[model samples]
Target: MRVLVTGATGHVGRHVVAQLAEAGHDVLAMTRNPATAAFPASVEVVRGDLLAPASVPVEGVERMYLFPEPRTATEVVARAKSAGVTRIVTLSSGAVTGGFDTDFQLPVEQAVEASGLEYTHVRPGDFASNTERLWARMIRADRVVRYAQPDAPSLAIHDGDIAAVAVAALTEDGHTGRWYDLTGPELLTRREQVAAIGDALGEPVRFEEVSPVRAREILERQGGWGAENAGFLLGFDDYSATGPSFDDVDWSATLVPSPTVEEVLGRPARTYAQWALDNVAAFR
Candidate 1:
């Protein structure tokens, strides 16, 4: 299959491209800046931006791995359909649980569904790598502070696992019209997550809980927390107080059986400890 992957340079997209290449699929790695795309030489890199659908050269594409939030998802899907693209595997978010009416993901999902292409929606939970954004500060200060609900638990799947699933869905058959919820094997609270990171680093990592109001203020000062994100975080916190039910959702019957990290990477998935050990230098 000739597969075109958008956001090919992103955290998960990069891994997806690698896995696709390893599986012997012809991969077209799409990026806005081809020069900056770090992918294997076997990948045919292309200059394309999802924001500008007209700029994409969609010839000879049999399948695609799409990332959500492109400016023109509908247009891009339409073009891919016209170009004889048979399958589309999208990297969608768990936020769609709130429904398309309230979530930004709905539009992308609608576009893909309407595209008339055989599609598999990969809806993954919180990414374990999202911790990297805060690990540096935690390592330096020896403390991790956030507006995390102490009682709420999340099964944060590793990005590599998510990518592996995407590759399977794109390359294998019998996944069409399916929505897979990819999550980690176990659920852990925010406090427990911090402890896990500390265990990985061979040190104590303290987690300080902040009130939602304080968290919002801090995020606002940082200039990156918008109202929607703030609401989502706070809502998630509230939901956690009752225990996270989403973590219990069944996924045993996926077309591609969930592969353990060790199985997918031929080594253990990078645990919080392993990640901390490997990236401790970034903390300095």
Candidate 2:
């Protein structure tokens, strides 16, 4: 099967492309800049911008791994359908499962579902890769990580694990119209996560608990995902900046570990410790 993977250069998209190529499928990796993106030689790279849906190369593509771009999702799905694409596996958010996501990934899932094509929504919770983005700089500069919620539990799933589930949905039958909620095999606190990274590095990393306001300020200055999501993660703001704060909800139920990843891939989900080891160089 020939699969077109949009956002092919992104964190999860890269894995999806690699896995598909390794599985001997024809993989079309769509990226904004094909010149810089790297993939297996067996995978073909193409230029496509989700914001501009017309550029997506769907010719002879039977399935797609869609990256959520809510503004153009309907048009993108329509074009894929018209191009004879039979199935779609969307990279959705676990927020939709908790009803907190309406403006973003939800729309993409809706668009694909409405297209009359076989569709599966892969909704993953806190990504283990986020730790690399949020703490790698701090750890590299000075083996220390400061956070507002040192005890906050997270089921940070590996990006590779998320892609594995997505690949299964795209290549296998009986996954159509299914929504798979993925998470790590176990729950780890903020301090524990830092400890895991420290273990991977063979060095002791200190975890300092800071006030939410101070943490937010640091995150704002750190930039990237840290800056963009600082307010919401710190309980001062939300996705729209108008919704209720993060503290308003009881997140205990959401913290429980889910077996969906293991159930889908027929193996145990990767742990944060393994993820930390895999990405130890970034911290170093």
lDDT (Cα, tens digit) per residue for candidate 1, span 105-177: 5678889998788998887767776665534454566456565566667667778778987887888776799
**Which candidate number would show the highest lDDT if scored against the true structure?**
2
- In terms of TM-score, the best-performing candidate is 2
Q: What is the TM-score of each candidate against the true structure?
A: 0.78, 0.96
The models' CA-based lDDT, in order, is 0.71, 0.92
Which stretch of 10 consecutive residues in model 1 shows the poorest summed lDDT? Answer: 251-260
| Residue 86, candidate 1: alpha-carbon lDDT | 90
